[model samples]
Target: MLHLQHDRDFYAWANDSAAHLRAGRWAEVDVDQVAEELEDMGKQQKHALAGHLKILMLHLLKWRYQPALRGVSWRLSIDNARDEIAELLEDSPSLATKLPEIAARRYPAARSRASLETGLALETFPVECPFTREQLVDQDFLPDESASGQA
Candidate 1:
């Protein structure tokens, strides 16, 4: 559980770091070391961390690629991407907290899927359980206004 929270904090820091980097606020950007530390926390931690990292990386890629190519308004793109990332994070509460009972009851299949989806990169940790949209909804893990449409 502590590991899970730590990974979530790492993700939040990485998101802030990426935002700072994008805004040219270099002094505020400081997530590389934190990311490394999160990785070093082991498999479970990596699993939780990777999902959040992947979303952040995806936004970074979008910010980098789109601006270089189409010149498609970077600010708007980033805003949209931020919303999407927030949605993804909200949808996966297990990545934020340890809910063993929820994991046992509602997320067994999702956990299995997350395991296969994350593969070798995050498999080394004991915290690599994957979750599904159905489980997320069933357990009401996400906020009322989350992407799951329950709100």
Candidate 2:
């Protein structure tokens, strides 16, 4: 019944599936759907971490390259991304183990995105990320905005 409901009414399927599991009616539970949902939930967290990293990296790039344009909004964006990344890691400590992998995958997209949004040449930014993962997430880190000699 739950399996049939899964195709027809997803919400009903979820409720019925959970009810069966709690009641030990394992035979009636949709194990395949439940397993898929569990896997997706884990993926969601990893994807979230990757997204936050990209945003933080994008802001960092903008801050580094466009030092004169830096202002309160950019700082807020950097801080918000930093705080969310911290909160995500604190909630899912295991995600910390994959931070390097996430950074590698997300940085290119971030660089491209920053370039597109800033109307800068893609080549303007390095092909690889300049900031280390530690510095990327560091609360005090702002990617040497001083390099551009902006006050």
Candidate 3:
């Protein structure tokens, strides 16, 4: 039970980190490097890291392409990411562990939309780059209180 809660908390934290990054909090950071780091993590670590990456990428898309939603603010993005990741984690047991690969496969489609928004001839979304588990965890950017009970 404790482990389960920890997993949940970790997932939530990851989602929030992603949201922060999307909101330009971590501007200039490379998402792909983050993703690669996540890919190298162990299963448990990967789960948590993936949660963060998904939130970040999702919010990035929302920010770049969905102007109406951008007015909603970063806090809302964090909250929404938390809720969305929670549901996704609950529904798909292996989602966290498999997120990097899943994301890689989805990158092309996501990039196309991003290109339209940036008006750049880039093949991928610069801000939507992947991140590693070590980078996410080591950053210690999220609220520690949120992971307290779970950890």
In terms of lDDT, the best-performing candidate is 2
Off by over 4 Å in 3: 1-58, 61-82, 123-128, 133-151
lDDT tens digits, residue span 1-151, model 2? 6667788998888888889899999998879889998899889999999999999989999998888898999999999998998999999999999988998899999999999988899998888777777887789977775453212
lDDT of 1 by residue, 28-79 (tens): 6555665666567545543554443333323333332233442345344434
- Give the candidates in order of lDDT, highest first: 2, 3, 1
Give lDDT tens digits, candidate 3, residues 1-151: 3234335685654665567688887753345545654676645544554555555544555454444445556446556655555566566556656655755655555556556655656543443444343222222333321222112
The lDDT, on a scale of 0 to 1, for candidate 3 is: 0.50
Candidates 1 and 2, the one with greater lDDT: 2
Q: What is the TM-score of each candidate against the true structure?
A: 0.20, 0.87, 0.37
Candidate 3 matches the true fold with a TM-score of: 0.37
Candidate 2 TM-score to native: 0.87
Query: Local distance difference test, per candidate?
Result: 0.42, 0.87, 0.50
Candidate 2: deviation at residue 31, Å? 0.9
True lDDT of residue 120, candidate 1: 29
Least accurate 10 contiguous residues by lDDT in model 2: 142-151
Candidate 1 regions with alpha-carbon error over 4 angstroms: 1-72, 97-151
Residue 34 lDDT, candidate 3, scale 0-100: 52
Specify the highest-TM-score model's number.
2
